[model samples]
Target: MTMQLAIEVDRADDPRLQAYTSIREKDLTSGHGARFIIEGKVTLETALRRGRFKLGSLFLAKSRLEPLADLLAQVPQDVPIYVAPQDVMDAVAGFPMHRGVLACGIKGDIPSPAEFLSQGIRAAAPSTLLMLSDLSNHDNVGACFRNAAAFGADAVLMDAQCCDPLYRKAIRVSSGASLWLPYAHGGTGMDMVNAAKAEGYEVWAMTPRAGARMLGTLRIPEKLAILLGAEGPGLPDALISAARPVRIPMSSGFDSVNVATAGAITLAHVFGQRT
Candidate 1:
C-alpha cells in the first residue's frame, strides 16, 4: 500500500508551514533560496512528473485531497503532504483558497547557451526553438512556454532580463508547460543569436523593422532558432543585426500583437510546415 500520510496543521503560525505564509507580503528575491511555490493541479502534476524540482511539501485544501489522491500517490512518501480546512488555508496564505492546490519545491540550475548547444539540437531533424529577450512579464513568458510545447519547439532560451518562467503565476498560466520544457537563461539577446549560429542553426530575429522578410515567405532551415522580443520596442538594433530579421503579416494600422500570441503564430507557421 502507498503510504500517503497527510499532516494537518490547525494554526496559521505553525513554522512547518512557513513556505505558505503571507506570500503577497514577501519578496521572492530576498530570502527564497532555490525553493519556489507551485500552484494549481496541472502545474503540480507536471512538476512531479518532470522531477526537476525537489518538493518540500504540498499544502492542499482538505476538500481537494480526495480529488488529488491519485497525483498524491505518485509523490514520494518522504515528502510531507499538508491538508488544511478552507479557513485554515485562507488564514495561512492570507488569501481565499479557491483551487485549494499548492506546493513548495526547489528550482534546479538553468544551463547557459554554450553548455546547452553542446547537447546538439543542431544535429536533430527539422528543429525549432524560441529565443526570448527582455520579456519582463512572467505571464507572457509562461504563455510562450505553452506555445513552445504546443508547437513542439525543441528548447527555449531566455535572455538575462526575461522573467523566471517558474514564477507561481507563470506556472499557473502555463498550465504546467513551463515545468516540462527544457529552458536556458543567460547573456544578452545577441549572445543567444550567436550561440544558435555557432550550433549551425539559422537564427531568425522576429521584428517589424523596415526591410525584414515576411514571415509567410521566409524559408526555415533544418535547425532554426527564432528570436522574439517584448512588445512595443521589440528587438534592439544590435541584436536584430545579429540575426536575419523576419516579420509577421498584419492588417493596415495594426502593427503589433501580444508577444506570446505573436510567438505562437510564428511557431505554428514553422512547425505546421515541417510536419
Candidate 2:
C-alpha cells in the first residue's frame, strides 16, 4: 500500500482532529457510534495488520513518526495520518497521552455468536472458544482475551452483560489481542452456551462451587467452550446448571481465583492437553 502524507497540526483544536478530542472522557462515554479509539503503537499496529475494522485515521505525536515509520508505511493511502507535537497531542487527549500513538477505527460489522461458532467447522479439529458472562471489569475482560489468544483460542464470546472489549483500556490491556481475536458479544450467558452446544462444543462452566469437577480430570474435547463469569458472584446458578461446572483445584484456604487468572489456567490446561 502507498503511504499517505502525514498532516501536521500545530493547534490542538484543529477541526481535522475532532475525533481525537477529549479522548479519555470519550473512552467512558457511549456516544462513539461506530468509532473506537486505539492507543499506543502496538495496538495501532495490530489494527493496521489484522483488525477487522477499517481505520478512520491515525493521530501521532511528531516524535513517533520516525520510530513508527516501518509500520506506518503499511497504512492504506485513504487513511489520514495526523502528527502533532507532544504538548498539542496531550492537550487533545485530556491526559498525558504518554504512548504517543493513537488511531480511530470504524466498527463496520461484527459476527454473530452463531457465525463465530461456525468458524473452523470443516477442519479436522475444532479450535478452542472462550466465553465470558457479566464481566464488567475492563481489565479482567482484556486479560481474558490476552489469555485466550495466548493459548490459541479461535475466538471469544461475551454475553450482553459483559463490558465492551473494544473499550480503550481493555484493548491496551489485552496487548492488542482484542484487535485481532475474533469475538462475538451480545445475548444472555445461556444464549452463548446454547449456541456453542448447537455447534457441537462441550461447554465447561468455570466456577469454584462445591461439587464442581476438577479441571484436570476431564479430557479436552475437540470442540470446547470455556465459560467464565464475574469475580464476586461468579456464574449464575441457572447458567452453571446448564453446562458442566468445572473448577481449578486451589489451596485449602482459597476456593476461588480471579476470573482472568482462572481463564489462563484453564486455557493453558486445554492447550497442554492438545499437545
Candidate 3:
C-alpha cells in the first residue's frame, strides 16, 4: 500500500469529512445523490471488488490502517484515504464509529430501471428478478437484497415507495450484498410488474390472500420476477391482482412471513429449480 496516499486528519469538522457527518439523518434524506457513504470493512471490500460504484475516498481509524493495508492497496491512486484517531473518528461521524472503516462511493451515471433490467437480462439467460413494493424498513430491504444475491437473482426492482437499499444500515444489514446487486428504484409497483412482463418475464406476486396459488405447485419460468411487499399492509390489492399470485404454505394459524423471509423462501425455490 502507498502509505503516503493516506491523509491524517485531527479535526472532526474538517470540510473534507463533511460527507461522513450526521450519517443517520443523511441516510434518510440523501436520495440518490452522486455520493454515498459505505461503512465497515466488508462492505468497502465488496464495493471495491464489484467496481460498479466508483470510490471517492476512505475514512478509517488509525487502528484499522494496519489491518486493511492489503485491501487498501487495491484502491485507485486518485482516491484519498483519511485516517483519524478513534475518538476523532467518533466525533466526526456522530456515532461510535466501531466498524473503523468507511468509504465514499460515487453513483455515477445511474441508468433507468428499464435499462438496468434489459442489460442484466441480456447478461444472464435464465434471469430472476426480486421486486419490492412499499418496503419502508431498511433491514427488510437489505435482507431482501442478500436473499436475492444468494439465490442467483439477476437484479432487483424496487417501487418508489420502498426505502433506499443503499442506505448505510441497509448496506450493513445486507452483509454488503447491496454493494454488488444490480437494482433500480422508483416508479410504482405496477410499473415494475408491467415492465418485467414486457421483457418476457413471468411475474409472480407473493401474497397470502385467499385463492392464491401455492408456490410449490408452479413451474419456474425462464425469466421470472418475484414481487414481495411490506409486511402487515403487504402488496396493494390492485397490484397483486395484476400478476400471478403465489403463496408459501403455512400452518393453519399462519398466513405470511416476514417480507424478506418470504422472498428467501420463494427465491430459494426458484434457485432449486434452476439447479
Clashing pairs in 3: none
Which model is ahead, 2 or 3, in terms of lDDT?
Answer: 2
lDDT of each residue in 1-275, candidate 2, tens digit only: 43578999999889999889997788787546688899988898899888878899999999999888889999998899999999999999899988899999897666667666765433657579999999999999999999998998988999888888888999999998988888998888888899999988999999998799999999889899999989999999998999999999989989988999999999999998897
How do the predictions measure up, each by TM-score?
Answer: 0.93, 0.95, 0.95
lDDT of 3 by residue, 163-222 (tens): 878888899899888888788888888888888888888989899987999989998899
Top candidate, metric lDDT: 2
C-alpha root-mean-square deviation, each candidate: 1.9, 1.7, 1.5
Q: Evaluate model 3: give its TM-score.
A: 0.95
Candidate 2: stretches off by over 4 Å: 1-3, 118-124
Off by over 4 Å in 1: 1-3, 27-32, 121-123
Residue 80 local lDDT, model 1: 94
Residues 20-65, candidate 1: write the lDDT tens digits: 8876554355534577788788888898888466898999999998
lDDT of 1 at 206: 88
Q: Where does model 3 exceed 4 Å of error?
A: 1-4, 29-32, 118-120
Q: Number of clashes in every candidate structure?
A: 0, 0, 0
lDDT of 1 at 125: 90
